[model samples]
Target: MNGTGNIVALKPFPDAARLELDDAQLRTNLRRATHTIRDKRLRVVGEVDDWEQLRLSGAAIKDDVLARLPELLERFEEAATKAGAVVHWARDSAEACEIVTALVKETAAREVVKVKSMATQEIGLNEALEAAGIAATETDLAELIVQLAEDTPSHILVPAIHYNRSQIREIFLSKMPGVTRGLTDEPRALAEAARKHLRAKFLTATVGISGANFAIADTGTLVVVESEGNGRMCLTLPQTLISVVGIEKILPDFSSLDVFLQLLPRSSTGERMNPYTSMWTGVTPGDGPQTTHIVLIDNGRTATLSDEVGRQALRCIRCSACLNVCPVYERVGGHAYGSVYPGPIGAILSPQMTGDGANKTLPYASTLCGACFDACPVRINIPEVLVHLRQKGPKSRAEHAAFASISWIMRDRRRYAAALRAARRGSAPLRGRGPLRRLPWPASAWTVSRDLPLPPKESFREWWAKR
Candidate 1:
């Protein structure tokens, strides 16, 4: 990715959201999924005795890493090289893709099995591989479904989250090779279908590609936390293994990882611990992959790290907790964000990563409710970053008009009362319906993406007059 390169074309938030808002099915899927995840996170997070302290510790550690990132990168490179793992530094996405492609070609592998990787998605690696005539198979079930459907991921944790099981059944039956029409949408049946589809690819794949959740600088170890066993297979089964890692993923030591292991699961999948947490240091001669490679990608991270306020986004562990709790995300879904990274985190992170471009509009995608901040295990202060980025971008016409209207309304008691009377009259018809979902013109800027409580049928001033 370049200074202005977007992970995906981010149409202005309001415009994209207008289209997403019209999709009743998408809204329903997002609401149900986010609420379920949010409730689960609250349940598991409540069990932790020192959750706040853990968040503080995690933030402090990441801040430390961000502070000394250049030094840590060198230390990590040296340690990883010493452990007999080849280390490659990529300045941008194109260079990183070229390096990985060259590595795969060296092994003469035409097909590679891939573990779900956000970094790879951000860099458009699968597309790059296809351009090079190398097939990249997504082993993650959601990823596979998206691939089969020829659709982009709409969420972080569950890429196919926008697709209901019935939709998935249709996709599998139509696109999945050898899938029987008898395949039902039952969770087990879907899992079985996907398993059978991917089993051959996993067993026969000569090269495997991945992204690291954490990279230990001192030990040259990489960690991947996953709910499914696919990542484990990708890490161990191939003759050659490659990991594309963001430079910020480097942790100084294993002791630092302890805090994160405790926080990430409860915050991400709402589990006490992951089903499969894979860790490896380079390679052992006859075990795992004899040839292991870790590509440290800078892309736009150096620029992002330079910004004092925005740098906090680097601390994100991709838990998706912020996404689950974000009202804006719950309604419009990740597609509206137009980034591999999405939700409240994406609102702040993508703009910084992509520089001054169409993504500049991303900072305004949030409601700034601070639910994201509360849910964040690492305490990234996402709302703060969103505000910081918004200040850097030019304000939208709707924002200016809304504030100007407020200024006018507050100037006189008569004006204010008239405005309130109008609001009450406008809401009277829909008074018992629900929250105000849409409003006229500039006001739609607020009500389009989020619902507002209906105005009171009678103003407090009217009651005061009666009294």
Candidate 2:
């Protein structure tokens, strides 16, 4: 695979195998978690009479923001610079990684605590930092579990959804340093264990790296909302803070934060309010992070913005509600998506980020059930985008050819009747069984995992004529 290119041939089955072996446990955890959150979200969302209107308004705001992203980004840079933040622009993941790595090296910080940042993950920042001899410790409880297990985040919000409590206990017992010899599969125990491990890092680390949930252009303020206080600690305790955020993450002003603050928490963890909603503008002397640097990353986001239908994905607040509702995502989980963003959002976002060609299969991963569209807080029409991409996809070429051939066959009624007669004659071999016991080659491959329905003995037109 190219360093920054999409992993087109990446199989979901391998990651699924690891998950399936612990199927009973994962099912129990997911069932409990998803049901609880689903109920809470429906209840809270119902309280607002204009919920649909709010969704439409949110989507419109994002569309408007994306329309003039270039202008707004420059405005953000100017404002942030005025507020004492040093702004660095990176065109791609490599440049972003290099900029972050160089910044950390210049600070001479060997260890850095991290708030859960998807941009950092997208650019492989931790790996880059490690290569530069910097240890990046993940502070989020789920992220810590993922980092310790050397596993990739399956879901954007819940990174370790693939791991059950017992699996987490196994990981802690094996990976966490100075952890108790025996660990139970209790949530409280796991959280305390993580807290002990990360508290030391938070107090001692000189630098912190984070991704903003939203960046306000008007005041140059960066926002991060999380259920855990660990993000707050990571953002505050470190002396020097480096935030890697996508340029597309910028909102026009601070007022826009109200719409997202309401949309994100309820949609994500199903909370009425997130425990920690942190916002900071540049450097504040005697406060959180005396030195602040924002690395504005444009890695494929600009390319995604250029796309008409696919651009709506940029509006995502990284709320994983769509994932929880997607049947395919519910079964295979996020690892199968093979990108930093996963599930329905990832399907549309990944192909757009990579540009459609050989990696077009990402769009087809959905069943087009529209469950994701219904669940999306921002009302991203995931099914519409999926079909749009499919039409522009590589498979469409073959489909077009098939259509032309079928059209040619159907143009002449005599040929069509002869074809149906041939079909009836050929299918005579399987008449007693009602359908062929087994097909051959390509046709057989379709039936390998499913049974084929028997064709009618007579054509519909012929039956109509007889009547």
Candidate 3:
């Protein structure tokens, strides 16, 4: 996958948010799902005595990897080539998509079974493959649900978190081929329904596509951490396997992986350890896939790396811990962000990826609440980055006017006092109504979800001068 998918083409965040806010059912689902995960994460994370230290270690390791990415990439290529895997480099999303599509065509296979890969989604790989007349099937349960419904993923870990069991059952019964009648919304029933649908694709697929959780540079072993067994199936069953990974995913060695292995599961799924962890070092001849290919994608990562303050976003493990604890996410949910990556991480990461173009409003989507920073396992200061991006963002005419007005007023004490008296008179109508629920055009946007406080009867300056 590549950078194209991350370049969101939707309404500005506030405009999109207006539609999402009216959906009461989405709010209930988001609140319930986020709270459940947040509770479980607290329980599992508390079990580790040195969780804070582990976070620090994780941050330090990623920092080292980013610092030495070029050298490590060279080292990783050498080891992977020796291990019999072909390595490809792509400077951007278009190049990455071309490389993967050509590789799939080389095998003469029309269908590829895909493990759940955010990297592929970021590049819009499925759409690319479909355009090239190759079918890419999503094998993960939640991902399959999203694909079948033709809907975008709403969460990182659980992509279909927006859908309840009933919604999922409907999607399956309507879209899933060969789905049996009388299918129930029961959890077991849903799993069996999806399993039956994907099983045929798994057996007949000749090519497999995946994204690595971590790539060890010294040994060239690519790691995929997953709860379901589907990732293992996709990694092994196919004759040709291709893994697309971001350049930032590489780590120096196995020792660094030890810290992340512990940090990832507890933060992502609230498990002490993942149910399945698939690691392979290139081609193993008759053991697994005979041919393996690795495409390391730069996309916009180099540009993101250039920003010292924004570079901290690269430390993310895609844990969704920040998403679970975010107040804004809990209220409006992921789709409103209009990026594959939503919530706090998306707020900072998306703008960095595409710059302040279509995604400029993303940085201002937050309330500057520090919850995301606190929930981050790697301790990325997300709020700090958000503020940094906002300062860097282009200012609107209204904002410039407002700031200019305040600046001018503050330059003179008499002007400030006169402004305060005018505000008191203007707010007198609001006193009878307690707080202003709605205001005029420019200020109406702010009052849509909030109310302005009533001004005091007399100015503090007036009372002080009289006293």
What TM-score would each prediction reach against the true structure? Answer: 0.87, 0.91, 0.95
| Candidates 2 and 3, the one with greater TM-score | 3
lDDT of 3 by residue, 1-467 (tens): 22456557377998888899999999998999999999999999999999999999999999999999999999999999999999999887788899999999999999999999988888889999999999999999999999999999999999999988999999998999888679999989999988888888888889999999999999999999998789989999999999999999999998997799999999999889989999999888789899999999987778789889999999988899999999999988889988888999998888788763468899988999899998899999999999999988899898889999999999999999888889988777767778888889888967987988877898777889899
Candidate 3 off by > 4 Å = 411-415, 425-432, 458-467
Q: Is candidate 1 or candidate 2 better by lDDT?
A: 1
Which structure among the candidates has the greatest TM-score? 3
Candidate 2 local lDDT, 386-437, one digit each (tens): 9888888765565678778789879999988988888788777677675454
lDDT of 1 by residue, 222-254 (tens): 999997899999999999999999999989999
lDDT of 2 at 353: 77
Steric overlap count per candidate:
1, 0, 1
The TM-score measured for candidate 1 stands at 0.87
Question: Candidate 2: global Cα-lDDT?
Answer: 0.82
**Residue pairs with backbone overlap in model 1:** 1-93
Count clashing pairs, candidate 2: 0
Model 3 lDDT, residue 36, Cα: 96
Each prediction's Cα lDDT score?
A: 0.88, 0.82, 0.90
**Model 2 ranges with Cα > 4 A deviation:** 1-9, 12-32, 355-358, 396-401, 410-425, 428-438, 448-451
Clashing pairs in 2: none
